[model samples]
Target: MINYNPKEWFTFIFRFHKADTFRKLFPLMIAVSLYGFILAYLELEYWSLINSSYVKNLSLMHSVLGFVISLLLVFRTNTAYDRWWEGRKQWGALVNVSRNLSIKLAGYLEDESDRLYLSKLIPLYARTLRGHLRANVNSDEISDLVEIDKTHIPNQIALRISGRIFELHKQHKISSEQLIILTKDIDVFTDVCGACERIKNTPIPFSYNVFIKKFIFFYVMTLPIGWVFSFGYFVVPIVVFVLYVFASLELIAEEIEDPFGSDANDLPLDTMCNNIEKHVKEILN
Candidate 1:
């Protein structure tokens, strides 16, 4: 994610970054300006478009079109943000649960080797889950931690950790109650994995995406015709600004919908995983 300092209002307005929306929308803004300029020149200078009732009536669309599309966009953006925030919360919960697991092992296991073995696996489970969500499990990062050959590496890692705790219980290193305590945190790990996987697999509906894209496309494209009467040649900048607002919202929703990825606006999974690892190691020590 792009980190920045909080700034005054003037600085906020003038700030610029390599935001995905800006890069994607720049060409569209230029195209909108050129489209508006052509329409204004043709209608006023050549006087061909000004004669048509359709050209004159285009601006009348703003009242109903603006209101309805705004409502739809509100729903669309909210749905996407909900998914993004939910993913963040799940990862945050995972970090806490991993620490909890480490603490339980430290208090229960007498042998330092057993505690170290199980506590180390907490961060490995997290890294494996990250790889699972991103669909790119790196062997080098996880090869030493688990068997690495299993297709479901995260779940198997969770099971292996649980199985070791059971072995510790069988050896009388920990009681049955300690086994339950450690298993409770293992359950939490699995729950978090399931929740994050749900977010990754279940996206917003296809119909909603299709409808929004079509509505925004035609609406922005028609703006040059709509506002050219009063603004004339000045419609170029107006259309560019208008397109920027609408398209930026659409792009923001798209960028945030899948928060698992390493996009600038995404949930910062790498940082969260690193924090989990650090916390786990500290508690295990």
Candidate 2:
């Protein structure tokens, strides 16, 4: 995600990041401005709707619909943010589990070879999961760690890790108590994977998303039609500003709703995965 100091208000106002909604919506804003201007010119110079009560009353309709649209946008933005935050929490849990597993194995395994094997495998699971979430699983990473099914890479890695712990238990390398402790951490690896998949696979309902977009479109399109009587040509900028605000909210919601993707607003999976590797190495090595 694009990191910045929240305190720097001027920097944010003066600068436009590539992912800024303003940049994405600028073309549409220009089109809406021109459309508003055309409607205003036609009404003032030709139709003479300024004196008509019917045209003037349309603003009241907008005022009521404006409240309804605001509520929808609020719900939309909140729902999207909840998904993003949940994904971050899952990754945070994964980091802790990786550390716990590494620490336990380091204490339980006396053989340098076994510790070395886990040192590589623990971090590889994080990297594998990163790739899995992005839907670009790299078999080479898993192959380097262990030979297992590539169909479900994260599950395979978790299984491999569990198998090693079980093998150690059978050989009396670790006691029953140590095996239980390590199994708890190992089980969470799959749990975290399943949680991330849930967030990535499921999304807000289709009808709801389409309804909000339609509401914004029709609302902004009609703004210049009604207000042209009072504001005349100035309705052009007014309509464009309203469109900018409403459209920007939808764009932001879309970007953040799928937090695993490459969007600037997505959760920082790359950095988190690197940290997992670093922490695991420190504890196991």
Candidate 3:
């Protein structure tokens, strides 16, 4: 995620330089713009050729449709923001739950060795979660965080962690009663995982996505035509610039809505997980 700090105007713009990665695919934008321009030209040309009374009627309809599409875009942006914020809040909850689990394990396990074993496991779970959330389970950072023996940590490391937790419980390293208590806390983590996964895997429905895309194009298409009588060639850059603003904002909201992806705008899951490890270990140490 972009650091949440005050930035100079130039710096703020520079921060989004990475957004250029997406801008390279200008074909889609070009296609849309050409379609818009053609539609605008046809509207004006057809009206001039026909000299029908419908020109005034079409102007009224265009105004009404423009207002409606603007409202829909605003609503769409708000809904996307809500999803992104909720996903981030869930991870915030996970951080708390992980800390609580560590404290509970420390309190419940009597033997120092048992406590230490549980302590290590707690951070490993956090690391595992970070990797799994980002779909980087076999990553070196996760492996290093968990300190899994080379022989034991297989390619399917996520499954390995789950299995080992059960083994630890069954071996009486952690009592069944304690396991029951721990599982509740684990369930909180599980809920966080499920929620994040849901956001990552599911997007706004196809209909909603299609509607928004169509609306933005329809809105921008009308923009240059509406201003062309006054702005002429200036209409070209103005329309593109305005559309870029909306597109950039929409792109960011879309990126953050998933929160678990590798995008720069995604929630800092690895950083959060590492912070959890450091905090928990500090408590134990």
lDDT of each: 0.84, 0.89, 0.65
RMSD in angstroms, all models? 1.6, 1.0, 5.2
Candidate that scores best on lDDT: 2
Error of 3 at 169 (Å): 8.6
In the range 234-276, model 2's lDDT, one tens digit per residue, is 8998999999999999999999999998888898888988898
- lDDT head-to-head 1 vs 2, winner: 2
Report lDDT (Cα) of residue 47, candidate 2: 83
Model 1: runs farther than 4 Å from truth?
7-9, 49-54
In candidate 1, how many Å is residue 5 off? 3.6
Which residues of candidate 2, in runs, are more than 4 Å off? Answer: none
RMSD of 2: 1.0
Over the stretch 1-285, how does candidate 1's per-residue lDDT look in tens digits?
767666655776766767757678888788778878887787778876766888778788875797888999898899999999999899989988988888877877678888788767888888889999999888786667677667888998898888898898899999988888778888998999999989999988899899988998888788777677778777888778878888889889998999999888988888888999899889887
